[model samples]
Target chain A: MFPRPLPEEKPLQRGLYVGFVALILILWLLPLFAVMLTASKTADEIMAGQYWTWPKHFNLIENFQAVFAQTNMWGYFINSLIITLPSVLLVLVFSTLTGYVLARYNFKGNALVFALFVGGNFLPAQIMMIPVRDLMVSVGLYDTYLALIIFHVAFQTGFATLFMRNFIAALPDELFQAARAEGASPWQTLRHVVIPLMRPALAALAILTFTFVWNDYFWAIVLTQSDAVKPVTAGLNNLRGEWTSAWNIVAAATLFVAVPPVTMFFLMQKHFIAGLTMGAVKG
Target chain B: MSELWKRHRNWLAPLLFIAPGALLFGTIIIASSFESVWISFFDWDGVGPKTWAGLANYRELFADPQFYVSLKNNVIWLVMFMAAPPLGLALALLVNQQVAGMRFLKSLFFIPLVLATVTVGVVFGWVYDPNYGLLALIFNLFGATAPALLADEHAVTFAVVVAALWPQIAFCMVLFLAGLNNLSPDIIGAGRVDGARGWNMLWHVVLPQLRQVGFIALAVTVVGALRSFDMIAVMTSGGPFGSSEVLAYQMYEQSIFSYRFGYGAAIATVLFAIMIVFITWYLRMMVRLEKETR
Candidate 1:
């Protein structure tokens, strides 16, 4: 209605709009399509200069298998899982509790504390890189899975708190009052009442946090040094160095690395969009 | 114990709940940021004893040609990335219609956003590969040759920025689409009655309503541009002799690769100083919104 719906448009204009949208979509997805095509082709086929054509040989399984068997791709994938799962869980626990407290309690320095988290979330990661690395080294966490997990949990808590606080705040206060009237302790009320109600928010945060931690490259490189603890993002960067001219293998590895987050996004599209666009829409 | 619990629970419960998050954020983010500023004044490798070097790193950084190159590239990224928000608004308007199969098309456009920045960088690296790349193929079709974008000092930063713009535009489009959904139908109806249509309707009526989302898009784009490290690291490694090095990548390269903890912290401090300006505005807006809701 804002731009005059296509139904009200002249036939010629509608057709042109459709054509234009379709063209833009193709251009937008062109690189992804090229990678997918390259991922399915043989090294020889890629070298044959028919990069855009249908593969002379469909080597999807072979290419993917080679990416795993030949490199530390599988190790990195497992490391990502190790790093992402506990990080999401820890961030959730911390943020949920923090959000609940910030939402329900009126206290001294509440606004200041909330402001700190909000501002900390937006600060460039570079600012903390040196000191955090030094801190990790001093604490003997550098190059360990724990290093990445701990840093991610702490850093993500800033954004997660902001999100969860706003979400919990929006819930009706009557629910809390009713629970209080029933002689429920605050912790009990949170466990039995708020937690159940917060499933959607928790799911949204989990999906978003999982994708974020999984795709993290900055801390991955800064904290971890070897394939023993490196996540897929850093591992793939390493693979790129080793497999420079092996375009087919690199393409296959890229897709393999992308699968988890892409699948998560597709499966949880609604929550993903909601989590990401939370502040943009309202504030 | 029971009496103590009963009496103090009112204040204690909230503090108990907030403790873990506050502690972690304080140590990792807040404390470390200040420490980084402190570290900038000392010369220390990861394993070495600290040596005081007040203003030496900053003075050297000011004279470093690489710092200037990084600063220039960052400006280029910031300027080029301004295209994303408007392009995103255009895409959002185009796909926001009730047209059939728009959902699938929208999801297709969302692909790059789902992929990791590293993956996106690698994919675009291939697409820009001079020998057998898509760009080369397109040029061959036109009876020309494609330049090796990542290999050229003058073009590498722009090439990487364009790849980054792909996902950034998608992010902005999603934000604008959400804004569009929240638009007041009454205002549009009123505008229609007043004979506003086409460009006038979009420019005057719809665009004004999208100011908040547009502001968010602009801020996020600015932050994303400044934080551009993974792409540069992946695509070119700030190569062609560090031509594509932005501040973030330069900082990382200096600390991790060049073994200059003090220098890296200096770069980080500079980047932080730039970010604090934006962060101050962003936090003020958030706090004001939080107050309004209360």
Candidate 2:
């Protein structure tokens, strides 16, 4: 009571923190602004290279048409959906079931299998790049969407399993024991008991896996070949071929293709993030 | 004993559980990852008969400074990568509210995380453009100069890391928001009633609750930092005399570009070993925490 609260403390410090946050946010958004502006700028303006400045003339429609014309950005977008959707579903379903098994069952190799998942999660993608690619080719799945999907589903399982298992294991063991006592078949127990209890976890897994597989690139590049099989991530690189100087087209293309996941994130950010950091502190 | 064993020998049940996931997991992830080690020993150009070079690649890597630079960058990334946790918490607190358009703001902040590495790389590559790029134009607007972030030896790696940090920070924010949202408000209200205000509330109550979330964020971020590849590949391609190289990038450079498959595998093994250390530590800590909770 001796010292009166400063009138500006709430506004100033919070303001300053918000300001600090805003400044960084702007920094975060700066490249996007460049991409947007450059995308709308005309070919002549781009050649002049006044990228950050306001467009003398906006031509977003035409520029996007050109981008689509050149890169088939939509085709790649569809390819991304094809690869991402199945992989994501596979991750959610498999990781959930596997996590349930590991969480409830104190079977042998429980620790070993869990450790295997951990180590698998940490292994660099590069080490597996050559062999994975060779395997894909040998198996005749090379240059196919299946190559990308299978690899994404398989590797992502390591992390996703860790996530789903830790989360499921945190649930009360009484539930599992109760389910077992009720004569719920293993499949029935998983479906009725484990899965129903895992709505949030399943939601979490879906959005996380969707974002990851949606944004995946290293494997996209390694596993698939040609524009026929390539996703939007790799297609953006293909956009850089000769029209590389066409910053407008590149920007337009980038912005166009970036819409799906960005929209998904904005829409389901809470669940998306919860899924991402589930194992961060603990695992 | 025989009856019990026979009763438990419903092999197909376990096999069904193990098949789809284990088959794909084993053949693709586990086995294929090690296959590189075997292939690395060969002088095969990916097309011809293999010729094994037991330790030749490892020697070359030991002598290569690029490998050292990449390793050093990895060390830098691992250390600095921890910034995600606190920074994320602070950011979540900043944006987690009932304000108008908070949802929009959260998504806006989250855009970087959603975009592919190719987009991030190319976008930053342009943003760091020395001539007429966005950053350069801003510098000129202020009547000063800007360095070529991608080309300048001093700033190249730093710039790339900053570019990488954009998505990474977004990632951290995601976790923190989740942590904050799930926090026990009853405990928070009790503390507030007990005059736990501001920093005390945050430190004594919030941070402790957030510890679980914090570890998850750190694990992902650390993995993100170490597992970086697509961005490096798309952005600078390990440019400015390889100042921006990291272990993953080096592994790719060695195995694919320079055709030093064996050396690349060794670098990967080293990276794997380092990651395993983090994994084990994380597991031990998590397991202990769970035990204590029980």
Candidate 3:
């Protein structure tokens, strides 16, 4: 609107603008389009150097099947779910509680506590990598799904707390004051008032956390080893090593690993964008 | 118990609510950060007994050429990644229309941000393949040869960074889109009455209003650049002979594969030290924003 909308009578100009945007979108997604093309091609076509062409022999299904048959892709998918869901749930619970308290309470060291969450969330994972891995190993949880779960919950809670606290703080103060005047306990207020109002924020947080925990590769590699516990991201990497020449199969596997998060994004675009820009744009 | 609960629940409840998250965050994130710094001064191979090697790891790191290479690549990432915000703003402006099907187009543009970086890396690795990649196909159309980007050490980091930028750009675009939506209509109307249009409107009236979102985008980009490990790991594994390695990947390689936990921790410390400057700036800005909102 700042640039001013084109006049409705100028149909040609609007058409041209849309066409130009379409062209840019095509260019922007060229890599992904190439992968999709590759995923549908037969290995023979790929070997014959027909990457960008329509496949002479379509083998999308076969390539997808090969990804599962050759590697632990299915097991890894399940492992990712196992690790990601519990982590997301725990992060939600912990952050909601932390967010509620930090938002509604007046206390000493409140700012410092909030700062820790914000600061810790921003630090590179590499800085804490060695010690976190060591801690997991010493606790005998290394190479287990719980290792990933615990670590994700602990780490993601930082960002989630920041998000949830901001959202909770923005709620109308009058509601809390009224509840307090009625002698409703803190837990009752949270359970009845805050919880009901927090649905949208929690939904956004869940989707964000799910994508993050599912797509995690660095911690998955650092914390776990066996195929039994590895997530799809790491499993897809292993498939890359195994099927080095099978670009079609590797591309198929890549899509498989990417499907859940992409689907979530499409299904909940509004919440996802709201959650993502919460920190950056103060939405 | 009920009377006691009713009397003390105000202070007690907040403390109880905060305990779990605080404890978990404190130990795993905060405590490990300190532990990483502590481990940097010792000699250990991840699984064995630790030995004190005062200043030895730091000494070796300073003498190491690979350290410089990694440091230089990090600078490259930081500099190259700065393009995301402006590019994102461009894309946001381009799509910020109230036309038919614009929603679908915007969502399509956001697809890259949701896809795993591992997936993006793999796809881009294929795209850069000298033999049968999209680049090769495009080159063939022009009767030119495509260079194997990942295979060329000089071009490897650039290629990887380009792939990473796809998602980073989308992220910044989302931020900018949100910012653009929140622009005050009155301000825009005033600017219009003043006869500000097109580039003049954007440069004067619009750009200043976007300063806060721009700062956030810049901070996020800096962090993304520094934390670039997944793409490097999946695509090159810090090769064509370790030329594409950034500090994050170098730290991982030293600790996990090379079994030099101490050396890795030292590298981690250096990276953390670099990040502390940005982290402090970001924290101050965010805290200030929080206070302003309050």
TM-score of every candidate's chain A: 0.93, 0.90, 0.97
> Which ranges in model 1 have alpha carbons more than 4 Å from their true place?
A8-20, B287-294
Q: How many residue pairs clash in each candidate?
A: 0, 7, 0
DockQ of each: 0.72, 0.45, 0.82
Ranking by TM-score: 3, 1, 2
lDDT for residue B233 in candidate 1, whole number 0-100: 87
| TM-score preference between candidates 2 and 3, better one | 3
CA lDDT, every prediction?
A: 0.89, 0.77, 0.92
What's the best-to-worst order under DockQ?
3, 1, 2
Rank candidates by lDDT, best first: 3, 1, 2
Error of 1 at A148 (Å): 0.7
lDDT of 2 at A127: 65
Q: Candidate 1 chain A — worst ten consecutive residues by lDDT sum?
A: A1-10
Write the residue-wise lDDT of candidate 3 on A170-283 in tens digits: 899999999999989889999999999999999999999999898899999999999999999999999899889888888898889989999999999899999988866654
Question: Residue pairs in steric clash, candidate 3?
Answer: none
Query: What's model 3's lDDT at B81?
Result: 100
lDDT of 1: 0.89
Looking at candidate 3 chain A, the ten consecutive residues that score lowest on lDDT are A274-283
lDDT tens digits by residue: candidate 1, B1-294: 999998888778888999999999999999999899999998988678999999999999999999999999999999999999999998888798767677777877877787899998998888899988889989999999999999999999999999999999999988998999988899999998999988999999999988778888998898889889889988999999999999988988999888999999999999989888888888777567546545
Quality of model 2 by C-alpha lDDT: 0.77
